[model samples]
Structure formats: C-alpha cells, structure tokens
Target: MSISPVNCPNTDCYWSAHGIPDKYTEARAWHLAAHRAEEHGELLTAEQVAYATRAGHTLPNCARTAAAVAAAPEPIPARWDRTVILPEHPNGDLDGQTIVCCITDDGTKRPIGLFLDDEHREALGLLLVDPNGEDEEHATLLAEVQRLKTELAQAQEDIAFTERNTLPELRRTVEHHQDGKKRWRDRAQKAEARVAELEAERHTTNEALSDAAQQLRANSDRITELEAELTKYVGKEPTIAEEMEYLSGCLNAVRDLCDATEKQATRWEHPLPVPEWVETVRAATDGVRPDDPNDNRHRILVDGKGNGWISVCSDEGTEWVVPIQPAAHVEQDVRDVADETGSLREIGRCW
Candidate 1:
C-alpha cells in the first residue's frame, strides 16, 4: 500500500483497517514523544513517559482499534497494550531494556517473538577482524593522542613558569613598599594593584589547563579501548565490516516497500461503524470459549434466584460471568444489562 509521508511504524498498523490511519496515528504520537524526549538528547524507552501507558488516552483508543490482521479470517485479537515489568540490570551503568509484552483476553502473558530488525540476525554476516586492521587504526590514533599530550604538557609548563616568576616578584614589591617609610606608600599601593591583576590572569589560565587536561585523558582512553576491541576480534571470524555491508543489502530488499502505496489508495474507504456483528464473532463461547476472560459474571435478582446471568466482556476478558447458579435464582441487574447489550439471552442459552 502507498504509505503517506506520515505513517505509524508499529507492526499492528500493518493490519488492513489501521494501515490507512496508521500514518497519522503513528507519526503524530512518535513526533509528540520524540519532541519532548529531545530535551534529554537520548532515546526514550518504554519506561519513559513518551511510550509508557497513558491510560486515559490509550485505553479508549485500543477499544476502537480494528483488528484487521493480514489473511486471517478469524479475528484473533490484535492489541499492543500490555503491562511490562523489566528485570533489574546487573550493572547499574546499563538501563533495563524495554520488552514486547501482551496480556491475552484470558489474562495470560504472551510475548511477541520474532526478530524484526534484520541487522540482529546472525545470518546477515560475520564480524570481520583482519589481523592487521586493528594494528593500523590503533597506531594512527595512538600517535595523535601522544601529540596532544605533548602539547598539553607544554601548556602546563608555561602556566607554572609565569606563576613562579611573575607572582613572586609582584608579591615582594608590594611588601617592600608597605614596609618602607611614607615615601614608599604610593609605590606599595601600585604594587598591590598589580598583584591583584596578575592573580586574576593566573586563575583563568589554571581553569583552561584543567579543561584541556580532561579532554586529553578522554581521548587517550578512547583510543586504547577501540584498539583493544578491534584487536580481540581480529582473525577470529569473517571481517565485521564485510558482514555489515552484506547485511545492509539484504535489509533493503526485505523492506519491499516498492509501489504498494497506490494499491491501498485505490480502494473505496469510509467509516464502518463498529459492527454489532463483531459481538457475535467475538463473544465468549464457554469452555468452548470461557464465559469471559475477566470472569466478572455474577448472579442477582431479575425477580428471584437463578433468573438472570450477564456476560459483559471488557478488554481483559473477565467473562462478566456467573457460574453454577440454578435457574431458581434471579439477578435483576443481569436483566437490565441484557436488555441493554443483549447478552442476557446468551445466559439463558448456557443451561
């Protein structure tokens, strides 16, 4: 199908009904969350508010979403809404990862499993480590680091020299003038003023040196780390660079975006009311389907014991169920809801 410039990138959006609207919904939400996350200058995981459940907005949206799974006639429930609890990371340095989670209508955990990102596939390519590749890159960066270190050392020396020679001379002059008789009072005042000016310059110079020193250390460590990892991988497997390029080509092909856009646009499109037929298609079928995933079905008086049962299914299939109640008893409330949603008949059929 022709995807507009705006499209929801989530997999659920691939369903026929949502595909048309996915672009607007996905792009809008993505941009909104991304805009807020830009302040942190990092990617927001599901734990972040950007992707975490906004129950007020999300619950209602899911209720209306069409389940148009591809080529499947039985509309297996399609939902992205799920509660996820991540395991603690062993090292505090790494953040816990976001995992794909799903709760079945029956309130069971079913995770989405499959590798969608092709680069993660081991078949794409092997890590290429030429025995000599690391040696060359390591030598180059190490040489640059040494040159920077030398420059930093020189800057430090110049700063120290100025402090030792200039500061000490200024201090002695100021003290001498103050200790001398009245003739030297003016000279002492001038000498102390000069010392203050010199001290300010020294403070600024010290700060620059400190900053440069940190940058130099960081550069040196980075070079060393890169060299070590590269060397470790050498000759152990196919070259990583070679494998990466091959994988990239395979990814471009799987994308298969081609010209499907025009195909979808060609279809007649309009709002189809949430069909009451969907109820028959989806309603609980007992142990045949289990009264409801939520199992909320209860007994009350339509007039007396066993007269009523209600199966009001919600997002998490609670069943809205009543069990083992004989027809002698009645639930009046069940009658009210059955009169409303037409589920009371299903209860009568249960016996």
Candidate 2:
C-alpha cells in the first residue's frame, strides 16, 4: 500500500517549504497547519480551515480573512485509493488495472473489484484469517478468570486477617492515646492549680511586706519625734572642748572673787566674816598661803543657804577662802546655781 504525503497549507512551515518526500502524513500536515496558525502567527486560508475542521483538527483563534472565507471552495470529500501492479494472465499477458479502496466504518481500507480465482481466493483467505482465533480467545478468558479467582481468595484472606489483627490493634492504640491524653490533661490541671496557689501566696506575701514597710516608716517617724523632744528638754549635748571652756570660765570667776576678798581683808584691818564651810576647807588644806593667787587651784562651793565660798589650794595642801554672801532677801540653794550655769560641779553641800 502506498500513502501520498499531504502538503501543509502554511507555506512558511518546514513541511511545506523544506521537508523531504513522505515527511508529512495527512494527519501530520493538518495538525502542523493548525499549530502554525495558532502558535507561529501564521494565518490559514478559509478552505484549509474548513478542511482541517472536517479532518477533526481544531485550530483555536486561527486568523483568516473575511474575503478568504467568502471565496473559500466547498469542502472536498475524503477518498482512499491504491495503485497495485497487476499479475500476469494465464495467457502470459500483463493486465493493467487500478484498485479502488473504500474506508470502512472503523476507518480501515477495503479494496473493491479485486479479482482472484477460486483456488487462489481460498488460499489467500486461509493465510489472512487465523484458524485458532476462537480457541486462543477462550483460553485467554479462562486464564483471566483463574487470576480473578486467586485475587478474590487472597482478598478474602486479607479481610479476615485485618478483622483478626489490625482492627483490635488499632482500637488498643486509640485507647492508649486517649488514656495518655487524659493523664496529660490531669497533669495540666494540677499544674494550673499549683500556679494559682503560688500566685495567691505571692499576693499575700506582698501585702504582708507592704504592711511591714508601713510599720517601719511609722517607727522611724516616732524615733525622730522622740529625738526632737529629748533635744528640747536637755539642749544639745556639749562637746568635750566646749565643756572644758565653760569650766575654765567658772574657775576664773571664782579666782577673781577670791582676789577681791583678800584685798578687802588686807585694807580693812578687820577680820572678814567667813562662812563655816570656808573654815572647814581652810582646815583641810593646812593653812599654807600661796603668793601667786592666779597660780592657786580654787574650787567654788555653794552652801544650802546660797553662800558661795571659793576654796583655794596651794602646793603645801594649804587652803584659803573668800566668802560670797547671797542677797539678804532671796534664798537660793547650790542646786539652783547648778541649774543656772550647767557648768558647776558640786562636790558636797556647804552649811
């Protein structure tokens, strides 16, 4: 059988411009023409579009001119033909004849007017047709049935095995997972409860600390107030140097009074009235008179009647006195002088 190559409708395509003989089959030419029209920007003629459509080739959005569509020829019907070499006649003559081929419903070619003798026709029929086609088909069907039966038996066994093993194992696995989930849920609940308890404890502790801080602040304020009251009552405590300065001033005052008294006694030529406490101090100091009055150590004593007496001491343990008489009207005691000065040191009461 000889099949002629179909020419591509698109002159730009390789099949039409440069392909070798037998390069494009009828279906291949129509497909390439449609592909060129769709993808390569090549336009097909209206007649080619109609022919490709009839040949079951689809061309999407293919470009065709309206004039071409109007001038398109009618669609030609498809035909199949074959040129066969004729056999020699029994009379030794070569007969020349063309065989007409027709397409069947299944798209196969059936040649009409093929002449053959009865013996040759029978021999050709025997060669073309399979003698054991029905037997082979039956054997194939039997093998297929046996295979299906074996598969069905295996499927039944698999179903039974799944029912016996896989289903129960799956159920146990699901139950185990469910139990684990429950245990985890319980643990999460317990942990949440513990966290809540800790939060409450922390809140309580914060409140307690706040109360303690407030109490400490109040105590500190009270301490400041008490210190202020103490300062008001006792005055500021003197440093050692300030106290020494005060005591030195008191000693100087007593010495001055003693010097004045001794000068008065020497000028008057009459014995001055000395308090009895001054006589006692003179007895205790052995009556040794000191030349430098400023160099002598003097202790000023105030009796209960507010009589101030200066007791003067020398290197020989001798004592001298200068009596300081209080006012005739006011009766002040030794403690009253101590309260007034704060620097006076009282050893004993002078009568």
Candidate 3:
C-alpha cells in the first residue's frame, strides 16, 4: 500500500500537516466542514434547513452553513482501484485457467478481458459477478491483521521497558528490606540476652538478701542471750564492757584490803592515848622487854579512867594488874596505819 500526504488548507486546523488521511479529497472536505462548524456554526445547507422546518424535523446545523458551503469548492473525484493477488490452484494444470475481475466501490466490474480460453472466461464471468463482497471481506481481514501486529509490537516494548527500568529497583528494594529485618532480628536477640542476664543477677541478689536476713536474726538472738546472762549473774543489766571493767576494779580493791590487813597484823599498834602507869611499867621492867614488841601480851592495857595496868603473876597463882606508864610513841604509829587503810570500807559493794 502507498500512503499519500493529506493536508488541511487551513494551517490553524489540528490535522493540517498530520499524515493520517487515506484519501486527499475526504480529508480536505472534513477540514472544511470543521472550519464551517467552528467559525460560523454552519453545518446544514439552506435547502436542508427549509426542508427540515417544513417536515417538522430537528436539524443539527443552522441555515448560515449553506453560505459556507457555497464559498467552498467541491472536491474533485478520483478513481481508486484496489487489487488482490489470488493464490494459484493446487492443480497446476488448471492454475492459469481462473480469472478475477477488478472490484469497484459500487460492486461492479470492468474486465481487462485477458483470457486463455472461452471456458475459463465463462467461468470467471460467473464467479466474479458476485457483488464484491469477497473483496471487502479480504480487506477487512488484512486491516485486522495489521492492527494485531501493531498491538504485538507495543506489548513487546512494554515488556522491554519493565525489564530494563523496573525490575532491578524492585530487587534492590527487597534486598534493603531483608537487611533491615536481619538487623532487627539481631537487636531482638541481644535484648533477649540482656533480659536473661538481668534475671540471673536479680536471682543472685535475692539469695544474698535471704542470707543476710538469717544472719540478722541470729545476731538478735545472741544479744538476747547475753542480756539474760547479765541479769542472772550480776543481779542487774549492764553492757559487757562496763561489767568487765567493774569486776576488774573490785578484784583490785579486794587485793588492796588483803595487803593492808597483813601489814596491820605484823605490826600491831594503836593510835589511842596511853595512861601514865602503863608507861611506868614498860620503863621499869627489864625482864618484860620482850624480843617482839608487837606481841598482844606486851601491848599495854589501858582503862577508860586514864589509868594503865600490866598483867602480872604472883606466888599464890593469882593474876594481878599492876599500874604502869604507857608508851606514847607506839600509839601514834598505829594511828597513821589506820588512816592509810581506811578505803577498805568500799569493798562492801561486792555483796
């Protein structure tokens, strides 16, 4: 098929230079109608409007379109001859015998009149006489096939575009999502481990607390025992340090008292006033001057009447009291000793 360039005479029309018109006159006539419809609102001829008004029928165009049609020139008619090559007959001997006539728009034929025999010519006349329906069917099928081929090419382009531009980006998006998922999984695992560790630490802390509570109870019981023992033995409650110090002090005081008593017994003395007679007897008797002057018998016996006496023996085996002067020096010495040992009374607290 050959394509001819069909253009609108009006450069302002949308179809002015676009190459889609199949026939020149048809495209030109359409553009002229479009111009009249747009610029003048003229679609019907004056005669058509009058006829519609008389018949009471509605028409789509105004009567002014008849003037546009009057100004536009009529398109020149052209003859178009469409041909199809028929297939050869399967019987090669009869291949050249068939004849096909050229089909016209009105379903008529003008034969080229080429014939090899009268028999073939008669057969073609009969066959080709059928009003061009077969030719139209063939053209319709050819147009359908062309449209399908164009659709197939467009589908292939779409497939190529998807493979080149869309698929890789989708793959990368999936990979990115997978990586994010992996990172979240790792974080979750770490969190789980941290939770377990905290639980274990809490358990250990609980055990330690249990042990401390037990030890506190034991300490409380021990304190109670110590307090009881203090009340039982010492007849009073006292702190252990205070009781130990008090007992140690008492032991020291008793030791001091014992030493004082031993010293006083070894050196017997008195700090009271001595009578004159007791001193006279001590000074007069040479034989009475004993080796130990601290003896109880040698100590002077003084009466409350300021008189002194010495125990004596007579020839009749009777005891006699003789008047004597007491020694004043020995009395003073005993007074000093008694004063030094006076703190012995404090030992009574031990009871």
Top TM-score prediction, candidate number? 2
Better of 2 and 3 by lDDT: 2
The lDDT ranking, best first, is: 2, 3, 1
What digit string (tens of lDDT, one per residue) describes model 1 on residues 85-139?
A: 2334343122334333444454555555222133332221121112234465656
Error of 2 at 56 (Å): 58
Which segments of candidate 2 are over 4 A away from where they belong?
1-134, 209-242, 252-351
Name the better of 2 and 3 by TM-score. 2
Q: Model 3, 125: alpha-carbon shift in Å?
A: 26
* TM-score: the better of candidates 1 and 3: 3
Give each model's whole-structure lDDT. Answer: 0.43, 0.53, 0.49
Q: Estimate each model's TM-score.
A: 0.17, 0.32, 0.28
lDDT of 2 by residue, 1-351 (tens): 343444456566443222213543544455455555544656776677777678644444445645766679964343434322234434321433322233433444444444444454343332223434556655675577689878975665455434433543576789999999999999999999999999999999999999999999999999999998888868578865566566556655665665566566666667766545543443333223333545434556543334455553333543344455453344344334546645334333333
lDDT of 2: 0.53
What lDDT score goes with residue 244 in model 1? 41
Q: State the displacement of the C-alpha of residue 73, model 1, in Å, after optimal TM-score superposition.
A: 99
TM-score of candidate 1 against the unseen true structure: 0.17
Which 10-residue window in model 3 sums to the lowest lDDT?
342-351
Question: What are the clashing pairs of model 3?
Answer: 276-325, 277-324, 277-325, 278-324, 278-325, 278-326, 279-325, 279-326, 280-325
Residue 153 displacement (Å), model 2: 1.7
- Candidate 1 lowest-lDDT run of ten: 56-65
RMSD of 2: 25.0
